[model samples]
Target: MRLDKFLKVSRLIKRRTLAKEVSDAGRVTINGRVAKPSSEVKVGDILEIGFGAKMLRAEILELKETVKAEEAKNLYRIVE
Candidate 1:
């Protein structure tokens, strides 16, 4: 899945556009390297997102085109 779509579907950023903007600004990384909004996201990939002064890291656990709000959290697992 596309990074932006994955972020939204996983409820990480709430919206696809916002996720795209964040990724475009270089505030997101995949496997420790800067990633673009159109970057491909696959299972087991590590994603680090910067939100203001805070940072969130997660490992992709699965990929889906759409998921219920209650199940979104299953798409990724938080990492330290």
Candidate 2:
């Protein structure tokens, strides 16, 4: 899945556009490197997102085109 779509589908970011914008602005990183909106997302990949004063890090658990709200949390694992 695309990074932006993965972010939205996984409920990490609220919207795909916002995710793309932030990613393009260099706020999103994959394996500690800046990632683009079109970056490919795969299982076990580490993702880090910078949001103002907050930073979110997660490990991709699964990649699905669509997911229910209840199942969204199953897509990734949070990492401190």
Per candidate, the number of residue pairs that clash is 0, 0
lDDT score of residue 52 within candidate 2: 95
How would you encode candidate 2's per-residue C-alpha lDDT over 1-80 as one tens digit per residue? 89999999999998999999999999999999999999998999999999998999999999999999999999999999
**C-alpha lDDT of residue 1 in model 1:** 84
- What C-alpha lDDT do the candidate models reach, one value each? 0.97, 0.96
lDDT tens digits, residues 1-80, model 1? 89999999999999999999999999999999999999999999999999999999999999999999999999999998
Ten-residue segment with the worst summed lDDT in candidate 2? 11-20
List the lowest-lDDT window of 10 residues for candidate 1: 32-41
Q: lDDT at 44 for candidate 1?
A: 98
TM-score: model 2 vs. ground truth: 0.97
> What TM-score against the true fold does each predicted structure earn?
0.98, 0.97
* Residue 75, model 1, lDDT: 95
